[model samples]
Target chain A: MVTESDTGSIQVEIIPSRFLLPATAQKLLNEIYGNGGIIRIMIHGPNLPRSVPYGPGRGSPIDENRDLLIEVGGQAFELSVKVGRIRLELESEKYYEGLKAACERALPISFQIRRGKFFHTRQTITDYAKYGKVEDTRILGLIDPKAKQDRLAILSEENVAVHDEER
Target chain B: MAYTPQYYPGSTSVGINRRKHMSGNLEKLRDIPEADVVAVMGHRAPGADYSSTHPPLKEMGEPDCPIRQIVAPTAGAAAGDRVRYSQWTDSMYFAPSIPYWRSYWGAINCKGCDPGTLSGRQIIEARERDIEAYTKAQYDSEMTDVALCSMRGCTVHGHSLRLEENGMQFDMLARTEMGSDGNVYAVKDQVGIPLDRKINLGKPMSEAEAKKRTTIFRVDGIPMCGKVGARKYDEAVDALHHMWELRSKWGFRPE
Candidate 1:
């Protein structure tokens, strides 16, 4: 979800457990911010809570989906993504391939992919101001940069073994 | 260290590894007039404490540039040998504590001779001074800040008519001179390239004395020592206008 404050401040949250995959969340973030600004990602799980900030500078506490606030030129922006089965409030927007490239730059591979699947696979994103919306929904699938080549190969290789399973 | 391969299109590597070949190319650049801007470049020599880093080169033309390059002597180069350098090492490199090798490029400056006879150092310095004066004249007249384009064709915003405040700043007030002819002529004194702004003269010039008549025009308020051509004043005016527009867009301080 994206929310803009009165002071030109912005807040975005993406929960992976609530989505099909992390890639879904990534796709949504990429669609909003084109470029010209920096994006920082903080990963928090079972054990790592309020841990040290990743990357260059030191001395900071960050938690998972708690809130990572970024301020630029006196304005603030925050992003938090929740995990596990979620009913996306916004309509699922069609995923763009370039979105994958953008995600690769910001969040790590694992979280980015999970977010992408969760958001793009299940939600419905609509233009509130304009009813004539852009259709961006795509087939249910996972697009992970790290697993792209291997996953495509696995899918193409006559999946005779998995076909035998009777669910 | 292992010998790395160096590649140059249609050019022989002189059978040396990448490091040596790079040094050779850098040497050749020192000789090219266009490459005179490369005052320093080199690979880190083995065990030679090569931690120094040269900052990105400033685009050539600007008024009152923090960086200046003249064919100045290197610590090792002979008195006649010249190298390009900034006015201050600290402003050029983010960190200047580390030691590094040096190189020189560009023309030399020689005073005393008429403007037309100048080619090497004298010509380069004259051009720089003339350009600076031109910008200053415009600033003084328009009462605004102007942009100064570097010799490298990069434009820097922020140049003003007001004198800069430095404890030891010299006065370079603008003035007008009238000679035998009755018309008033504007003139400015020349400022030498700073100690850090040194570049070596790439090619030697024939020191021939030519019988040439020259005129002078003041640019901005800075005094320039040069023989002005028929259209030199117009050219100076155009340069100032271009810089003026640029500085305005870049939010330069007029002060």
Candidate 2:
């Protein structure tokens, strides 16, 4: 039951895969859940690969200096970012060459993973036959660090890939 | 016994005698009673001797100030349909001498010689001074006062219509009673001017009678009252004439 004291208990689902920029995703997050609280969950898109850095790479070193964990409303939450390159690395890349190739070809998409259960849910992008148009409300929430490659894959699959190569 | 006939020279029964035989005329005038004169003139005539020979009406019909015609019924008509003749004229005067006399004698004459001792220039100056004083006094007296027409100057037999200067504008004061038709008609003046003309009492007198009186009141191609700028003096006089003609249809004759 939601009460006046449950003000801080409110959670926001950020669909990072939907928004174009990180700032746009953050703005939508601020609008829905306000600015002061912790963003509890992120539902990463299925097409996005999951990968992390294993060995020391040739390129610039990752700055893991910043605290990845943020405290909100007395609750400790883990911050996870979805990168398309990380997703590609999870599926195929085993060495520095694969990582570099993934970095070049793959788009970065991230989502916050916390407590095993999915708080953010995905809405289906149906064919134009069942629904004439898609409404913004159908997009339940945006995932942080939107998945660009996943969107490309979805557009190509729908056969509505009009401005692909240049865009 | 035979009675002797007494005869006064240059005497006639009509009572008009030469001015020279004044004493004889006086005695004869005394013998005739005041009532006899009234009886001869007629019982309806005004008690005053306001005959055509009177100074005011004497020159009335002359070219100088042409006589005004009567457009209403004469005084001899029925009770509800009679017209009476009444008129008054204003005479203005100028008295220039009073101020000049006072100033000249008070200032200059007191310091100087008598009449015989004065020089030619002094005489001319004195005469000029007197003339100036007289002319100014006359002008002042002329402009100072005006004779107003009022109910006091009116007669019971006829309604009185007065035209007086109201500030800078001229207006008419009409005093009258209701007619047989229950509509009040202004008493037409001796000069045929109606009191207030807005009522359309002169032409096409009423809605029903309009067709009959239209020809009489229409002048210069317009009905007198409806004419443009009818409030102007000449237009007003024309309108008054129109009203007079309407009243005359009822047969009121001016004396």
Candidate 3:
């Protein structure tokens, strides 16, 4: 269960002008993760299906841009979507500057940083129906509730230590 | 008194480009070989004879009618060619041509053709040979920016999506890919069937060139409702508004 103090975390969304390649996304993630002020991060984009979903090419293999692996903070995971927008939950308002700097260092194209409520603060009815009594509120909207496998990739110990120290 | 047809109304570059497309006065940008175009189309093998639906008009005597006599049969129609279709998905991010404009181009320029315009993609159906000629014309002209437009026969889902970092439009089937040599290539047919060899589609236009050539009125480039800083409807909008007003009035009372 998340305490009342955790509800005050600042949320920021980074929307790039173009969908980033897996390597570019990894670079961006590494840069941002290195900054140490982020509590949680979620990458969002259009899904790259494993097979041709419909039409005459249905069931055909689509290898390009699908099943890509990206490492962030020493943890690697398969990227299902082409990275377009990245939403972050920061410990405080002070971390916004660091986040902006990280984006600048990694991105070659223009991007927009918007500060607002982008994630669910608490579990909803749908979350209850899908997840069945979620314990960690931070993981509330990180992934699709009906996803077969957990998409969350926990970073290394040092990164978790930094998050723990901030708390 | 004589009146010239004003294809589209606006002082902006977008309007001018639209007019050029509708008038079939597009500048030839590349010379993709007919065989390569045919391969990308995936209808038949290169150098193969066109399959026909019916006997040639010369052999199958037509009814002696004034309409039939006045309209001379096109090459494909005279040869009794099969009706075939070609579809294109143009990126919304400053693609040279949009679905509506493509339909307009087909309607105004092509003979014995049917053009369909959807939200994301546009398609033209004509006799097999005629469609091939039309497809080649579009591929060779400024109407198609290879990176921003693609030949998608089915599962057309990339028009409104953000482009890849390399600037190529998002294609779910991976029909086309940008080669390391800086030119785009079609590795697969329009329907996602792998081609025997990659066909070079020439270099993509620069961002500035695409913006200048694009018929879409975008907020970042040229806004349909207003300029960059100013707030005034473009001449195209005004013309459309006038037409709508007259249409509504006529609809109420057909005099």
- Best DockQ among the predictions, by candidate number: 3
Candidate 2 lDDT, tens digit per residue, A33-95?
Answer: 222223222333222112212211112222331233433333333334321111111111123
iRMS, candidate 3, in Å: value is 1.4
Q: How well does candidate 3 reproduce the true complex, by DockQ?
A: 0.54
Order of candidate numbers by lDDT, starting with the best = 3, 2, 1
In model 3, pairs of residues that clash are none
Worst lDDT 10-window in candidate 1 chain B: B90-99
Please give the TM-score for the first chain of candidate 3. Answer: 0.83
TM-score for chain B in model 3: 0.96
DockQ of each: 0.00, 0.00, 0.54
Q: What would the per-residue lDDT of candidate 1 be over residues B1-255, giving only the tens digit for each residue?
A: 998433211111111211232232321211222222222111112134322223213322334544334543232222222222221110111110101111111111222112211111111222222323322221122111111111111111111111111101111111112223332222211211111223332221111100010011223211232223443433334555777889878965668
Best by TM-score: 3
lDDT of 2 by residue, B1-255 (tens): 897323212122111111111222121111213332222212123244322212333333434332223333222221121122112221111111112222332233222112211110111112222322322221122111112111112221111111111200011222222345543333432222222231212111222222221112234333334445645433335545777889878766677
TM-score of each: 0.15, 0.13, 0.89
Model 2 CA lDDT for position A12: 26
Tell the DockQ for candidate 1: 0.00
CA-only RMSD, every prediction: 26.2, 48.8, 5.0
Candidate 2's C-alpha runs over 4 A off are A1-22, A35-40, A43-52, A55-60, A64-78, A83-167, B1-255
